[model samples]
Structure formats: C-alpha cells, structure tokens
Target: MQFVQQIPGLLLLVTLLCCDSIRAQDSSNMANMTSMMANATNMTANATSPTNVTNATMVESPMPAQMPMNMTQPQQQQPSIWTTEELVTDLSLPGAPNATLDVRYNDSLQVTLGNKLTPLQASTAPTVCLRNVSVGCEPPFALLMVDPDATSRQNPQFRSWLHWIVVNVNSTEKLHEGDQAVPYNGPAPPKGSGPHRYVFLLYCQRGRRLQGSELAPEKRKNFNLAEFVNKTELGPPLAGNFFFAENP
Candidate 1:
C-alpha cells in the first residue's frame, strides 16, 4: 500500500516538471520575437532617414549635377583676327612674299588695304614700320611704290608707274632712314583713272650695296617689276602691301 502511494506522488512530480519546461520554452520564443521586431523597426527607420535619402540621390545623379553652381562650362575657341602678312598674301602679287607692314600716316593714322585717300592727303610722306622681327636685327631690303592702275583702269598702258624707290632699308629702321633712290611721289592718278591701286613692294638686298644713281628716275613709265628685280640683282621680293588712292 505504501509503494502505490509513492508511485502517485512521483507521477505528480513528473507532470509539474513538464509544465515548467513548456513555460520556459514559451518565454524564450517571446524574447526572440521581440528582438526580431526591434531589428525590423530600426531598419525601417534607417531607410526613411533624410541623410540616407540624400546619399542615395547623390549616387544616382549625373557628373555635371555634382559640380558647384558658379563653375563655368568649357568654351570653344573663336577664330583669330587677320594679320598684316595675311593681307599681303591675298593680293596675289607675283614674286612678292608676305610680311608684316604697319603703315601709319598723318599722326599715326593706320593705313590698310582699300583705304581711300585723297591725292592731297597721300602727298604727305607716310611713316612706315616693320614689326614681328627679332631684336637687334637689321636685314637689308628694297622698297618700291608703283601704280598697277596707271593711266586708265580699263587699259593700263603705263602699268606700274614707279613712284618711289628706297634701297638698303633694314627691318629695324624706318623707310626714311634708308637710301631713297627715288623720292616719294604720292598717288597722282589721272581724273578718269578711277580708284587706283598703289602697290608697295619689298625686296631683299642680298648683302649688295646699291646706289641711288643706278636707277633712272626720269624713265618711270611702263616699268616691269619682274624685269627690274632681275636687272638690279635683287632677289624675289620679301613682301608687298598696298593701299588705294584717287585724284582729288
């Protein structure tokens, strides 16, 4: 009888132990679920944060958008202005090379191609200068002033009427400082000659001394520029530029 009573007590004790184990398991599962929910809430908050949104936007933006507002965009370069040498080349003068001829007159007034000048204004000797040359440089050259539209524009019988001639002109020196073979006689176009082209030619002296007496100033008409260059032994012209003038 005592043994049977002891069995019932043992059975009760086993049942209570099982209940305690089940309660412990339920408490552990609840704690794990709470932890998971907290983690999920933190993740949701981070996704909606302003700083995170800004970072994401920056990552998706183009390169130009990231630049400062005041920054300037790259600009294309423009074409350059015409130089003196380039203007001479456009004339298509035979044997005349291109050079920088800066012509000024009447108190530094710039003279360029197609520049209209009254015979009176042109009569005054103009100051001529050379630029874009080396320092302490002196290269001997010859200068000639001629009218391609002499006598008449339609039929130029006396084409290239020599007006002025200067020899031994150095690139560093002015035209007046050199040897003036023929004195400057500004444009004297005939009344009906229309607008005449007074071409100025520059030639290299090639280290030879030239005398003003060698040229016959009296015979200025019908002068062929190429023939004169050959006779004088002056090599092909270094450069040439010209201006326009008409009878007053």
Candidate 2:
C-alpha cells in the first residue's frame, strides 16, 4: 500500500517538471518571432523612404563630376587671332576678319597672323586662296600687301610701303591672273631696326571691277588702304593674314 502511494507522488512531480520545460520552450519561440517581426518592419520602412530609395538608385560616375552641366563645355572660347594681333586698332577696321585667307608664299613658307619669318624667306609672292567662295555668286577679289611699320614701328614716317597689290580676281585660285596693281617687293627692314609687320589684306570687289592705272613708286609710300577702298568702293576686307619679318 505504501509503495503504491509513493508511486503516485513521484508521477505528479515528474508531470510538473515536464510542464515547466514546455513553457520555457514556448516563451523562447515567442521571443524569436518578435525579433524577426521587428527586423522585417525596419526593412519595410527603409524601402518606403524616399531618401533611402534615392541613395540606393544613384550610381556614382566619374565622367559626370568632370564634365559640365551639359555633356560638353560651352565651345571652349578661344581668343580671336585678329584681335590678338591688334589688327582692328592698327588698321582701323570695322570688326574682325569674316573668313580665313590662306597665304602661302612657297611650300616651305606658310603664313598666319603674328607668325615670325626672316626677310629673305618672304621674298616671293604668296599664293592667295579665298576657299570660302560662294557658289554662282562669285565676286571679284583684291589683295593689298603693306608694311605698316616702314622705317620702324616707332618712326613710321614711311608707313604702309606697298609691297604688292592685285585687283579683279574672278576665281579664287587665280590671284596671279588678276591685274597686278604693284609688283612684289621683298621686305628689307634696315639692320638694328626692330621686327616689322607685313600685312596681306583681301577685299571683296563689288559693284564694278577696278580699271586702275600704273602706280608710281613715290605714291607707294604712306599708302592709305582705307582711303583707296572707299575710293574704289571695294568695301571692307573679307579676310587677311600677317607675319612679322626682321632683318638678319
């Protein structure tokens, strides 16, 4: 009888122990679920936020930082060659040159504004080219070569010594074909004098072609290009080039 009573007590204690273990496990499982739910809620909030979304979408690129707002820089403005050479102030022209004038004396000697050349190098006549000629409406052209700094830049009493001139060129390539107003004279800057600027000017002949007379040597001294252009109604020069020459 005693043994049977003991067995019932022992069974009750065992049942209590089993119930406690199951309750602890259930509490642990509930804690884990709560943590998982908090993590999922944080992820949803981040996904919905605009700032977070933008940060995730943006891709860092090297080119964008280097380039301007527009894909290219604003034409990267360069200083006009005409203005740099002070052609406007020196010649008293209305504005900058309208077109390019290719002035090549020889295969070895090509000329641009402000280019330096020896007096002996620029001896021959240059082949002038106005390649930007309009179609059908080809106008006659004129070229005037002058030395603005005749004696010296400071003492320009013999200013604008006309070295060469041509008038009424129908074709762009046929500069030699035109009437030679003055023959080509090579630059002869006196020794000890500074560099002299020799300007090659091209004018678009409009209205009527020039029937010019033989120019005397005395008249070549102090030649006024502006006055002649106005007299002949040749209009402003379309293009021009210049080079600096100094005696050896």
Candidate 3:
C-alpha cells in the first residue's frame, strides 16, 4: 500500500512541473509576438512620415492630385506709354485732326512744341505745311498763336495774349499763306517776365470756306482761344506745336 501511494505522489509532482513549463512557454511566445508587432508598427510609421532617408529631415508633403498648383510665376503685361496719342494727352493738347500731321518752322528747324527758342528767332511767323495735301483730301484748317505765360511766368495777368490768328490754311501754304484774320506779331516778353510759352494750335472745319470774313480783335490781350474756336464752329485741333521764349 505504501509503495502504491508513493507512486501516485510522484506522478502528481511530474504533472505539476509539466503544467508550469507549458505556462512559461506560453508567456515567452506572447512576449516575442508583442516585440515583433512593435517593430512592424515603427517601420510603418517611418514609411508614412514626411522624412527623407538620405537627410533624415522632415519634408513637405506633395500636393494632392485634386488640388490646383501654380507652377509658373505670373507674368505682368506692360501698357503702351510712349505713343503720340499718350504724349498729346500728357501735354493737355486734346482735339481731333489729321493723323499724318507735322509742323516745321524752317527747313532745318523742326517744330516740336515745348522746345526752347530765342525770342528774336520765334518773333516771325513759322512755316506750316501738310503731309499729303496735294492728294486733295485735306480739309480747311486754321491757326491760333497764344502766350499762356504772358506778362510773367509766376503772375500771368494777361494769361493768353493772342499773337496771331488765320483761317483757310492747307498743307501747301505757310502760316502766312492763309487769310490773315489777325496779323502775325512776334513774342515780346517783358524783361524779368521769365520764359513764355508760344502755343500754335491748328484746327479743322467741315467746309473749305468761311461765310464772311471774321474780323479779329485789334488788341491781342486777353484773347479766349476756346471761345474763338467754338464760336467759329471750328472742329477739334488736329495738330499743334509750341515754343518757349524769354526776353533778352
């Protein structure tokens, strides 16, 4: 009996040891699986993150396919600033006239308004001509000479002193070639009056003739250029030129 009891105890001890071993093996296997999962998760995070392998630096993510991306810089369009039309407006010479218009005082002296000229040289009437008046498409025109800087530059008591006025002019003739509504008078800026602007404006009319001869003002002081042009029904100016003169 004693021997049989001892055999049972021995079998029981062996069974307990086997159970302990199996529990330890299961714990070890669970730990290995957990480690493997952690490593896999770390690899996935590195792949998805915005980091380059070479520099290990963070980088910006690329734009999505659905998003609009501007790859090129915007180009600015430049406006035209150096044309005859722009220059006219800049100089406050607004009117309508022949497109192919040019003015010259003498063969070598071209008239570009606002240029400087000696008082003595600009005293006489300048020569005016047309580009293609011989073609016969030219309309009747007129000319007016005024001094905006009359009396003095700082104080223009006599704002616009009319120097000359003429009508029935065409490209073929000089300013003196036209009918002398007002006889030409040279610039006579007073001493210490500073430089004066002598403006010569050309105007257009529908018909080639004036009904009756328009008498010009005897005195050239305080002449209203706008009023004269409008009252006579002269169309907008087509071309104009001017010069500056100072008393010697």
Instruction: Specify the highest-lDDT model's number.
Output: 2
Candidates 1 and 3 compared by TM-score, better number = 3
lDDT of 3 by residue, 70-174 (tens): 677688865322133243342234443333335555555666655778877766677766554442336567777778667876787776788887788754456
Whole-model alpha-carbon lDDT for candidate 3: 0.68
Order the candidates by TM-score, highest first. Answer: 2, 3, 1
TM-score of 1: 0.58
Measured with C-alpha atoms, the lDDT of residue 94 in candidate 1 is 51
Per-residue alpha-carbon lDDT of candidate 1 for residues 51-115, written as tens digits (9 for 90 to 100):
88878755454556466779987998643222342332333345334554666668566667557
Clash count list over all predictions? 0, 0, 3
Q: Over 4 Å off in model 3, which ranges?
A: 1-13, 20-101, 130-138, 172-176
All candidates: TM-score:
0.58, 0.65, 0.60
- Stretches off by above 4 angstroms in model 2 are 1-78, 132-137, 214-217
Q: Give the alpha-carbon lDDT of every model.
A: 0.70, 0.78, 0.68
Q: Which of the two, 1 or 2, has more TM-score? A: 2
